[model samples]
Target: MQFLQFFLCITVLLLYCNVSRSAFLCELNQANPFKVALTSTVDIAGKGNFTTIQSAVDSIPSGNTKWIRIQIFAGVYREKVTITYDKTCIFLDGAGSRETFIEWDGHERTNTSATFTSYAENLVVKGIGFKNTYNLGPKQNDLVPALAAEILGDKAAFYNCSFFGVQDTLWDVGGRHYFYQCYIQGGADFIFGKGQSFYEQSVLYYSLETYGQGTYIGYITAQGRDSADDPSGFVFKDCVILGKGKAYLGRAWKAFSRVIIANSKLSDIVVPVGWDAWQFVGHEDQLTYAEEDNSGPGADTSKRVPWQKKLSEGVKGNGHVKFKCPTFLKFKVKAMAVTLSDDEVSDNESDKTGLGFVKSIFVPETHSPNFVPSSKPPVSEIVKQAEVTPPRKIRVDL
Candidate 1:
């Protein structure tokens, strides 16, 4: 059956290979420098001559430029767009995430045959808003909307950007990516797809406007596919999670998945168990889920399940500055720990957590034998709650 499926995939690739002027697939690994800007309000701004995004893309050379800067003016764009590989090494700078908005509502499952597109390499998305509203509703929705922005090439970065939606918001369907000082709000698996990505100092908001208690909120990172050699997972650090429903910090979308969270403020919205096993699909025990120094209303660990990790001082380094964790989970825990210290707090401020404002990590001096993985169900049941009737057909818009 696997071989048959592979054959079918190859057949489809060949059939669609010559349908349109294929976007140049330059080696995304190469570093290029190019600069462009979007400062128009025309129907096809950068389309023909510095008017439309499509036009600017159509004019880019068929390779990764050294550096490309596309400065954009503040505006609300109501068009569905795609940036091809030819526009590699492109930098998009808008007024700000809140000031600039690019919105569309099209679901592949609902609008079957809509071929979702992608961006090129070194695509820096700074100060812009990308949103899709397919699943933004008041009930258990079945619509998996098309991505707000899809990055298919490598080394993509988004600084101070906002991705708004209720389902998959930022689809990292390609290479290494990073998001810094960004805001992503949704209810389900907001940040989904396959990529070696890192999200730092970002705010993840869970919306109850769609599915009240039944809604799935909070996902710092969720990994599904196992890429060949690259770090095929997600790392979230120094992030703030806020919502009003029971939501796991994250879960293994597929077996062998990995996710790390540290030094972040957690609201009571986070589930006690924290991580889900996704029904123990294939490699159940191989998934990596861990957390470090975190404080807030949701940082209480006494009632938390044993599977979740506690911050430790043993991993300290550089005179209490460094912690022995990877990427996203690395500095946030320690940073938050230091920042929450009572000694550092002013005498006028009250300790809200009641755990004191000092860095009192839950590190065990000795390995506790009672520490065991709990059997509680994961907090996120968005997919399970969705009774997708009469399975909708996928739309492949090319």
Candidate 2:
């Protein structure tokens, strides 16, 4: 009888352990079971690899060459997230901008203002919403500038994301960055910094009641290129600038500030005098504020400030200006090539849908050796594969 009881107890313990392990694997492999074989991937849900985005980020080994993908499930993560310089090749994949949001309240003066700050190289952030919830005012005087995201990383790309704040919504602080199909909301000098950045097919929203009140006066950019030799500038191409108040295209944050808004749609909210001098005097000639092929009610250049350049005839807008680094151009070429090729395919696949465009940014149909697809796999095959494969090296902070 004693021997029989011992055997039964051992069997029950083994069964319990197996079930627990299977459950853990199922949750970790919720999106893609074979993702473990492709690249280092981590899933962050309420009950997954790690509860918070920061915890998942912290677990990543520094100076990593392989891309580490952090797939965040739908939730409001109220935390100040930062990707340090040592953590390179990190891909942040969120469920969707509307579903996954990372928010915090910080300001420029306090040095803790940015809700999302990245200082890593080759970082990709997609389908997420980054917000700075610092309130700005009371209809009369008080105003504060907070940053939603500060991208100080080289070759960083943000796709299908949303940045929300009152002032300084996006600080393109340094390096070469690209914002594609992203929504940025702000008021005073919202898109600022000394970065060679491009905003393509993105929405720049100027909120009326968000910043300092009374009259609706807002400025979109304040590019801080200190010298003419600096290869830093902002290019807004095929973007939509629409919002509730009057705004200037940009102001001279530095003497040789450079900005170009080309082939974009501007709403009537854009002021006729579309550029400002700010406090800089006698720097008009040195500044490079230009507009080309822009349309809509606000694109009338006749009333624009005389200092702002109207690109004439064959001269392309800022064509000679090159990015400070080489990797940025390479990344841009790769992205454009992928997009163009995908457009040629005629199959009505799920990845070709409107929502699929957003998904494609982070989860490519086929991945490079360094990347992993974040799509669901066949259940039967995945289970078999999981059974044979060794357990993934993931730290679960339960």
lDDT of 1 by residue, 1-398 (tens): 00001111111121112132222221222222221222222232443235455455555567644344555666766666677766665656566676666776777652221122455754666677776756655435564544566767765667667776766666666565677666676666767676756666667766534454455445544676442222355656666676546677776766656555666677777777777777664544355555656667776666654544333343333323232221220112221221111112111123232211111111121211111122232212211221221101101000
Q: Which stretches of candidate 1 lie over 4 Å from their true place?
A: 1-51, 110-117, 137-142, 212-220, 225-230, 281-283, 302-398
- The Cα error of candidate 1 at residue 396, in Å, is 33
Candidate 2 lDDT, 1-398, residue by residue in tens: 00001111111121112122110000112244433222333344446677788877887777665556788888889899988987776778787677788988786562468999888876777678888877533333346777888889766877667887777888999876777667787788889998877777667777745444448688999999776445567877777777665888899999878787777778787889899988787767767787777878888888888777544332342542111121221231122100001122111222222211000012222322133223332222222332334212111010
TM-score of 2: 0.70
Q: Compute each candidate's TM-score over C-alphas.
A: 0.64, 0.70
Output the number of the TM-score-best candidate. Answer: 2
Error of 2 at 184 (Å): 0.3
| Candidate number achieving the greatest lDDT relative to the actual structure | 2
